[model samples]
Target chain A: MALEAEVWSDIKPIPLDDGPDPLAPIAYDAEYSEAMGYFRAISQRDERSERALKLTERIVEYNPAHYTIWHYRQQILFSLNKNLNEELDFVKEQIESNPKNYQLWHHRQVLVEKLMDASCELPFINEILNDDAKNYHAWTYRQWIIRTFNLWENELDFVNKLLDKDVRNNSAWNQRYFTLFFNPTKPTEEFLTQEIEYVIEKIKMAPNNISPWNYIKGIIAKSNKDIGILEELCKEIEKQDIISPHAIGCLVDIYESRARKGSATDKEEGIRICTLLAEKHDAIRKKYWEYRKVILTSL
Target chain B: MPTEKEFVRDKHISYLKRGLTLLPKQYASNDTNRMTLAFFCLSGLDLLGALESEIPEERRKTWIDWIYAQQILPDERNPEINEKICGFRGSPFSGLPFDPNGSRESRLPFDAANLAMTYTALTSLLILGDDLSRVNRSSIINSLKYLQKDDGSFTQTYQGMESDMRFLYCAVVISYILNDFSGINIEKAIDYIKNSQSYDFGIGQGPGEESHGGSTYCAISSLYMLNKLDEGLLSKEKTLFWLISRQESGFQGRANKPPDTCYSFWIGASLKILDKLELINYEQNHNFLMQTQAKFGGFAKLIDNYPDVMHTYLGIAGLSLMNEPRFLELDPAINISKKAKENLLNNCAFHKQK
Candidate 1:
C-alpha cells in the first residue's frame, strides 16, 4: 500500500555523530522511524483492516517486547479472525527469539485461549522450560495453559520431569503447589499423603534446598488439618539437620501450632532449637530469631 | 564481555539526551509507555550532572508542560462522576489533544490516567523543577479509592485492570509524593504486601506466586514508603536470605534464573532499602553491569541485548547505589538522585512558599 511507502519517506541512515552507536556500521534510523510511522498509522487506521494486521506483524517482528503493540495485535487478531494455528506458529517463532519477553508469552496466551486448544501447548512449553528451567514467564504461561485445558493428569508427570532435572527449581516447586491447589477434584487424603512423602524425600535428598521446604509449607497450609506424618518428619529431620535449621524451622512452626491448641508437648524443645537457629545458621536475621525465641519461651 | 570495566558515562549521556527525540529502534514499541522512558532519560541525565548543562531549565519547563498537559483530571464541579477516571495515562498516544494547562473537559471515553504514568509524570515534573501546583491532588486521591480493591492491592485505574505489586508500588509512591495516605487503606495495603510473600520469603506480585526481583522490589519499596517495612515483611531473615542469594556475580530476578542487568536495580535497590547493600560483591556487581553497557551508549537488560532507555536508567541508578563516582547519589527508596529529591522537596513545594 502507498501508506507503507509514505510512512518510510523521512527515514535516513543515522550518522554515527548523531546516533548512539559507533560500533555499528549498519544504522537503524530508517527502520526505526518507518516502524514508528507505521505504528502511528496503524493506530489511526481501521482496526479490522488487513493493512493494520500486516503492520502489526512487521511491528511485532521488530519489537516483540512491546506490550502495547501486542495488545493492539490481539485486537487485530480478534477483529481479523486470523488462522489460529498459523498465529500460534508465528508467536512460537517470536518466543524463540526472546523467551524472557513477558509480552510474547502474553500474546501466546491470548491466541491459544481465544482461538486454539491448549492440549498441544504442553510439549512446546516443556521445550522452552528445558532450556531455562527457571523461565518464570514460561512457567506462568504453562500453568495457564494447563488450567485452561484441564490437563491435570499430565501435570504430575510434568512436575516430576522438571523436579527430576533440578530439585532446586523453585518455579517447578511453585507449579506443583499450583497443580495441587487447583486440582478441581479435591486431592484425596491418600494423594496428599503421597505428596507429603514426596516432599519429605526431596528434603532428605537436599535438606538445605529451600523450594521443597516451601512446598512442604504450602501443602500444610492447604491441608487445613494437621498431618501426623509431617509432624513425625519434622521431628526426624530436626535431629538430622546440623548445618542448617530448616527442619527445625518446620518443627518450631508445628510446636507453636500445638501450643495454640494447648497440646504442646515439646514447647521446651522448640525453644531450644530456636535458640540454636538464632545463634547459628540464620544469623543475618538474628533479631527475628531472638524474637521468636522469646515468644516461645514465654509460652 | 567488555574487558574495560568502565561505566561509559559519556555514551550514556548522549543516549539519554537523544531520548527527548525519536529513539533508535524497537523503542517505538514503547511509544505508549513514553512517560516511563521520559523519567529514565531525564533522571539519568540528572544523575550524570548533564541535566542543566545539556538540557537547560527552559527546555525542562517544556517537558514538564508536556507531562502536565497529559493529565486527565476531574471536572471539579463533577468530582463524583469525573473522579472515577482520574490518574495519568501513559502517553498522549490515545489521540488526546495536548493542552499545557490541563483541561478537565478533555476527558474522553478511554481517557484515564494510568497509575504507572501518573507516577512517572509526577517524578518527571519534580526532576524537571515543576512545582506540582497544577496537579489535581484530591481527584487523584479520590480515584485511588475506587482503584484500590478490598484486598488492598491497586489496579492501574478505576475501570478495571490487574491489581498487583507493580500498581501497589505506584499507588504508594503517588500517595507519598502527594504527602497523603488518606485515600488508601494503609492497613489493607500492608496486608496485601504481607500476603504476597512466597513461602520461601521473597515477595511476589500476588499470593502464592513465584517470588520475583521486580515484584520483591515493589513490595519492599512500597512498605518502606508506607513506613511499614518492619511489620509488613513476613520473615525478614528468609527474605534477606533470598535477596542476598540472588546475587551471583550480578543478580537474578528469581532462583535458577540467569543474572541480568535490570535486577541490579530491582534486587539492588531492594537491598538498599533493607540496609544490606554493603553485603553485595561490588567488584562482581560492577563488572557485570559494565558488561551490559553497549559500545555506543545506554545499557541493556542482558549482555548482547539491545540497549534501551529503561535499563539504561536502572543500570545507572543501580551503580549510583554503590556510590559510583560518575553518577549522582541516589536515594534508592524513592528511586531518584539526592539532588532531584532535594529539588522535589525544596522547589516543588511552591504552594507552601506562597
Candidate 2:
C-alpha cells in the first residue's frame, strides 16, 4: 500500500516533459497538486540546496528560449554566492548561448572585471578590446578606468590600438589630442613630433575632420621653438580647413610663441603664415590681432 | 553685431515668461506666491513689451498687498534674521500664518528672504509703476544687512546654502534698483567677486569653483552697478578680453561647454555692460541665435531642438543686443524697461535731495 501511495504522489497533473503518457496525462488539478507537493518536498528537505536551480533548469528544458527563467537561475546562483567560478562559467555559457544579447555581454564583462580584481582590471579591459575591436562601451570604460588610475602609458597604448583599428574615429582621435593637453605628465617635444606625424598620416586619409587640424595648431604653438614639424603642420593645415578659427588661432599662437622665444626664423615664418591664413580665414582675424598685441607688447 | 542691451532684454523677457505658468487655482502656491509669480511674470511682460491690457489693476493691487505682507519689523524680540525688512519667500510651505515679521509661533525653517524672490519682488513693484512708497524700506535694508556675510557674499536666505557671486550680484542689483546702498557692505562683496575670478578671467560661483559664464556676467554687472567699474578690482581690458573670447559663434559659459542659448545673455551682456561688445563677431552670434530658434516660434536648448520659454527669451535677448531688425530697443544697464528705467531715473531725480 505504501508503494502505491508513493506512485500516486509522483503522478504530476501537468506533464513535466516527454516521459510516458502515465495514466492519460494526469488532469490539470492533479498536475497542480503534484507540482505543489514537489515544491513542498524541496522546501522541507534540509540539504536540497540546489533545488531552485534544478527547478529553473527543468523549466528551461521545456522552454529553451526563456530568458526570464535563465535570469532567475543566474540570480539564485549569484545570491547563494557560494561558488564564484561556477557563477563565471554560467555567465560565459549564457553569453555563448546568446551572443547577440548586449545585456548578457555586459554581464559577462562585469563578471570578467570582478574575476580580474583591481590590479589586473586595465589589462583585462585591453584584452577584451583586442577581441572586439568595435566595442565602444568597452573602449569608453577602459578610458575611464585608466583616468582613475592615472595610467598614462596604458592610455597612450589604448589610443594607439584604437587608431590602428580606425584612425578616423573622431572620439579616439580627440582623446589622443586631449591626452597631450591634459595629461598629468608633461609631453616632450620629440613625443609630440611623433604624435603629429601619426595624426598627419591619418588626416591624409580623411581631411574633413577639423579636430586634427586644431591639434596640429596647438602642437605648433607650444613647440614653435622647433620650427621643423610646426612648419610642416602649418602648411598642411592651410590646405585642409582654412576657415576653422581654431586652426587659424593656433597659427597665431605658434607665431606669437616663436617670437617670444626669440626663434627668429620661426617668428618670421609664423607672421607670414598667420597673415596668409588670416587673409583667407575671416573668422581668425581677431585671434591674429590678439597675438599681434602680445607680440608687439613683448617687443 | 547684436548689441548686448538688445540680447539681455530680449533673453531676459523671453526666458522669464517661459518660466512663468498660471498654475491652476488648486496648484497655486498661495496668495503670497501668487503675488511673487505675478511680480516676476508681470515684470517680465513689462520688459517684453507684452504687458498692456493683460495685467488687471485689482490683481496688481492684490499682489502688492500680499508682497507687502511679507515684511519684517525691526525689534530685538524677534532674534531671527531678516526680521526687519520686506522680501519675498519662494512659497508658503509651512502654512504657518503669514508673518511679515518672519516670526510666528509655528514658523518653519523656510521663513526668510529668498534672493531670487527679493529681486523679483522689487522689480515687480517697479514694473507695476509703483513708486515703491509702500515697501518697508528700512526693514528691507535691515533684512539685506543680515543676509550678507563677512566674506562679502550674500545667501539666498539667512539660512545659508553656498555663498556665491550670483547672490552678491543680486544684492548689488537690488540695491542699485532700489537706489539704496544702506543694506550691503560694498567693499567686502567686491572683494569676494574679485577673489572669485579664475585665471581664465571668468568669474566662478565662489573661490575654487570652476569659472562659468553666468557668474562672470553677475560679477561684471554688479561691479558696474556699484560705480566700482575701475581698474582696482577687475582690470577693464582683461575682463573685456575674457568676455570677448567667450564668443565662439555662439556663447558658452565655461572652458569646454558647447555654446548654448543662455550664455549669450550672460557673457554677451557682460561685454555690453563693459562697452566692449563690438569686439565679438556679431553676425556669427546672431546667425547662431537665429538657427537655434524653434519652428513653433520659441527657442530651445540648442539648434534643431524643441523650444522652451527660457531659451526662447534668451535667444530673443541675444538677438536684441545685436539690434536685430524688428526687435525692441533695450537698456544695456539693469536690463529693465528703458521706459521703466527712464521712469526710475525721473523718480530718482525727483527724490535727489534725499
Candidate 3:
C-alpha cells in the first residue's frame, strides 16, 4: 500500500505545527499524522475527488469522532454522487466499532435521508442495541429512523422484546412510549388502557423497577387521565409482604394531586405515605419524602 | 481489594499534572478535543486548589498562550464564511502554522470551531487567569446564530454535527462567558430544553430521548445560566425526584444503570443547582467515589476500571460538592472551581466593567 503522502503525491501535505507554546500535544501515531497531514492539504484545496474521499475513510478509521472529516465526506459523497449503499455499509462498519459516536450516527442519518430509504436501519440499530441495550445514540437513531420511515408498525413488538429481555431497560420503555404516543394522532382511550395494563403486568414482574412505573405515569399524564386510575395497582403492590417504595410513592402522588383539588382526606393519606417513605422503605431520600409530606400537609 | 477511604488529594493532583504535560497515546483519539482534555486537567487542579502550587507561573502563562493560539478568528478575506466559524478549534489539528499572536491571514476550510471546545477553551483560559482581551467576542457570538436550529437546539459546529442538549449547554455557556445572549434566541433555546424533559421528568439529550444524567446536567445548567431554571423544567418536583433517585451509591445516569463516578458530578451538580444537595447521603456518595479511586492516581468510572481525564476531573468535582474539606468549593453549574468563576467575573473584560 502506498503511503498517504505518496498516494496524494500531487498535493503538498500541510504539516501540523504545534507552535512554540504547545499545550499537551498528543504523541500521534506516525500513520495517523501522515493521513491527517494529507487530509488537511487536500481539504484546503477544496478537493472533493475520489482520492479525497478515500483519505477521509482512513482518517475516520483513525478517529470517527472528527465531525469536520465526516462533513467533508458527506460533501464528497454528494459531489461525486458516490454509491450511497456502499457508503452506508462503510458507516455501518464504523458504527459497529464505535456505536456511541455521534458523528457516525449523524452521517448515517444524512445518508439515509438522502437515499430516502430507511429499510435497513431498524435491523442495523437492533443489532447494535442487542449488544448495549441502553446505547443512547442507537436508541435515538432508531427513533429518528422509525419516525422518518414511518416504521411504527412493528415497533411496539420490538420494544416489548427488549423489555422482555431486561424489563429494567429504561430506553426500551421510553421507546414504547414514543411508539404509542409520539405521533400525529394521540393514543386512543382503549390503546391507553392496554398500555397501562401492559405496564402494570411488567411492574408486577419486578415491583421495584422504576421504568414501568414511570411509563404508566407517562401514559396517564399524556392522556390527561386521572392519576387515581393507578390507585388500585399501587394498592395491590403496597399490600405485598415486601412493599415497593415506588408503589407507595405512586400512592403519595395520586393522593397529593387529589388533595390539590381540595380533598382533605386525600391530603392526609398523601402525608401518611410520605411519612412511611421518609421513616422507612426509602430512607435514603428521607428529606425528599419529608418535603413531599410537608407539601401535602400544607395543601 | 483495599480501597481509598478518603479523597486521595496528592495522587489526584499528580494525575492532573501529568494530564496537563503529556497524555497517554490512547488519548490521540481526543486530539481534536485537546482543549476539553486540557480544561479537565486544569480545572481539576483548580478544584483541588493545586493550580498555583503544581504548575509554575511561567508554565501556566505558556499554557494560556497556547490555548489562545487555538482561537479561530474572522478571516478578513472571507468575512461571511469566517463569521460562522470564528470561535476556538479544539487544537491545532488543522495543520495551520502556529501563530501564538493569532495573526493568521486566511482561515482554512474544515478549521471550524466546535461549541464544546469553545466553551472549554474559555473556561480553561479563565482557570489559567487569562483576560478576555484576545477573544473575538463578537465573531463567536455571531457564529452562535448560525449554530442555533429552528427547534432551538444548537449544533456543535456550523458544518452541522449532532444537535443535542450537550451542544446547547456549550452554546449557553459560551454566551454566559461572553456575557451576551444576543446571538442565540433565548426563548427558543429555553423551549428546546423544556421539550427535552422525558416522561420520567429527567431531561434527555433531545426530545423523545431517554433522560440521562449527563444531559440532565447540561439542561439544568443551561437553564440556570439563562436564569430560567425555576420555570424551565416540565415539573420541578418530579425532576428533583428523578435526580434524587439516581443516588444508589455513586449516581447513575439513568434508572437501573450501574453507579459511575462521573454521574456523581453530573447528578450531584444537578442536585446542587436545584438546592437539594443537602438531601444526598454524603457519606455513601463519598464512599462510592473512593471505591473508584485508582491506586496510582485519578478516579475511574467504576471500581477496578482505568481512569481517564474526564472522569477524574468530574470525580474530584463531585467530591468537592459534598463539602470535602480537602477540595475547593465547586460552582456546579459551570463544573469549575468557585475561584475560577470569580476569576472570570473579576478578571475577564466582559465582567470587569460590570
Candidate 4:
C-alpha cells in the first residue's frame, strides 16, 4: 500500500530515514495505496486531457522529479490555457520545496522562456542564492538568465556584492570573470587595467585567498601585460608575510613565461625556483616540478 | 563524533537494498534519479562485498532487464531520424516503450538518452554481472557526436542544454567503456579540460569557473582514461597541493567548503589516480566518514545528517580507496569494484577480438 484517501488524518512530515513519502498524511496504509494507485493509473494513460493533468499535478506535488508528470502538466497547461502567471507561482513553490530537483529547474526555464521576460528571474536567482551562495543549479540558472535575457548590464555589480559578503566565494569570482568576458563592448585595455587593479586590491587584502590571485593572473595573461606587475606584487606580499604558495606559483608562471621568451638568466632562476618548489613548499607536486626542471634545463 | 569505530556495513547494505524495493520518503523527490539510486545500491553492495548474496536472484535478472529497457536504441522504422538521438534516458518517466526486445520506435518527444544515466546504467549493469552484450554501444557512441559542442564540452543531451565537466566526464566514460574514442574530439576535449584548471590548480566545470572537487575528479579521471592525464594537465604541483589539502576530516569539494561525504570519494579517487593517495591522513578521513554514517545505515553529506544514496555509495567508495576492511578493492579511475573493471576490460578485449 502506497498512498490512499479512504479517510482523513493529520498530515505529517515523513521520516527522514525513508523514501517515497506519501503525498499527504492519510488515515490508513490502504488509503495511501489507493491514492497513489489512482495517480499511476491515470498517469499510464498519458493522455493530454484535463483529468490526466489534474492527476499529474497531484502526483507531482509528491514527486517533482517524476518528470513525466511535469511533461504532462506542461502539455495540459497549453491545452487548458491555464494562467501562466499562476503556473509560475506554482513552480516557485515546487522549486522552494525541492530546489535540488533538476526537473524543477528545467520546468522553470521553459516557463521563463515562454514568457519572454526575465525581470523576475534576477530577483528569483538572488533569492535562491541567498539560501545557498554556491548552489550550482541556482548559479547555472542565473547564467542562463543572463545569457537569454541579455542581463549582463548588472552582472558586475551582482558579483561584486556577493564577493563583498564572502571573498572566498569562488563562484562569485567566476561570475565576475564571466561577466567581464562577455561584456558586449569587449574588455578593453583600460577595462583590463581596472579589472587587474580590482583583483590586486582584493589579493592585497587577503593574499592567502587563491581565487582573487587567479583572477589577477587571468587578467594579466589575457592582457599580455608585463610580468613586472606580478613581481612587484610578489615583493609587496613578501613584505607583508612569508610569501604564499599562490604568490610563488605566480612568480613561477612569470619566470616560465620569461624563459619561454629565451631569457637565459630567467631560465636559470626558473629552474632554481622550480627545484626549490619541488623540494620544499609545493612537495605535493614534486613530480611536476621535477618535470619543469628537466624542461627548463633542456630549453 | 561517534562512539563506535566499527564500520556498519550491515546497516548500509540494508539501507541500499531497502531502497531498491521500496524507496524511502526522503528520496521521493529524486524519482527521475532512480537509475542513479540503483547504481548506488548495486555498487554499494559490491563495495561491501555483499552484492552477490544481498540481491535476490530474481532481482538481478529484473534489474538488468529494466536497465536495458531504458536504453535508447535507434528506431528501426525511422532509422534516419532516431539514429541521431540514440542513448539511454534516465528513467521510465517518459512513459515510453519498455522493451529489451521491443521496437525502439516509440516516437516519444522526450525519449532521448541522458548522459549521467547512461554512465550510471552501464556501471550498474557491470556491477550486476551483466555482460553488456545487449548494450547498444554503437548507437551510444554515434549519439555522443551530437552532444559535443564546438569547443569540445558536451551537453547532457542533444537538446542544447547546459554543457560542462559533468557531461564531458560522461562522454569520456562512455567512450572509454566502449573502447572507442572516434566519436569524441580528443584534442579539443583535452583543451577544455586544461582550460578548466583554475588558479588554485583544481578543475572546474569550464574555463574561468570556480574549481570544485567533483569537477576536478571528472577532469582528471577523464584525462587519465584518455591517456592524456599528464599532457593536458597544468600546474601539477598546485593541483596536487590543492587536492592534498582538501582532506580535513574526509574531503571538501573546494576551499572553505565543509567536508562532505561525496568529496571523500571524488578527491580520494583523484589522489589515487595521481599516485598520491598515500599522502592523505587516513585515520582522520576514516573518523570523519564514520561520523557521517546514519544510525540505521548509509552515509550523509556531513556528520550527524540523514544519509542519501549518492553520498552513501561514494562514502563506501572513499573508504574502499582507503582499503577499509571487508570492502572490495575499488578501481578508483572509474569508481567501480576492481573485479567489475576486470570484467569490463575482459569484455572489451573479447569484443575487440571479434
By DockQ, the best candidate is 3
Worst 10 residues of 1 chain B by lDDT: B103-112
Off by over 4 Å in 2: A1-279, A282-299, B1-40, B56-58, B70-86, B96-109, B232-235, B304-306, B325-327, B348-351
Worst ten in a row by lDDT for model 2 chain A: A18-27
DockQ of each: 0.15, 0.02, 0.72, 0.18
Q: Which stretches of candidate 1 lie over 4 Å from their true place?
A: A1-132, A144-153, A181-210, A213-299, B1-6, B20-22, B75-85, B102-112, B149-152, B157-162, B182-188, B291-297, B303-307, B325-327, B349-354
Q: Order of all candidates by lDDT, from best down to worst?
A: 3, 4, 1, 2
Preferred candidate (DockQ higher): 3 or 4: 3
Q: CA lDDT of each candidate?
A: 0.75, 0.56, 0.87, 0.76
Best by TM-score: 3
TM-score of B-chain for each predicted structure, in order? 0.96, 0.80, 0.97, 0.96
Comparing 1 and 3 by TM-score, which wins? 3
Candidate 4 TM-score, C-alpha based = 0.81
- The TM-scores of all predictions, comma-separated, are 0.75, 0.56, 0.97, 0.81
lDDT by residue for model 1 (A155-203), tens: 8788898899899998888888777776687788888878888888998
How well does candidate 2 score on lDDT at residue B127? 66
What digit string (tens of lDDT, one per residue) describes model 4 on residues A63-140? 667655576678778778877778888888888877776778888887888888777888887888898898877877
Q: lDDT at B18 for candidate 4? A: 76
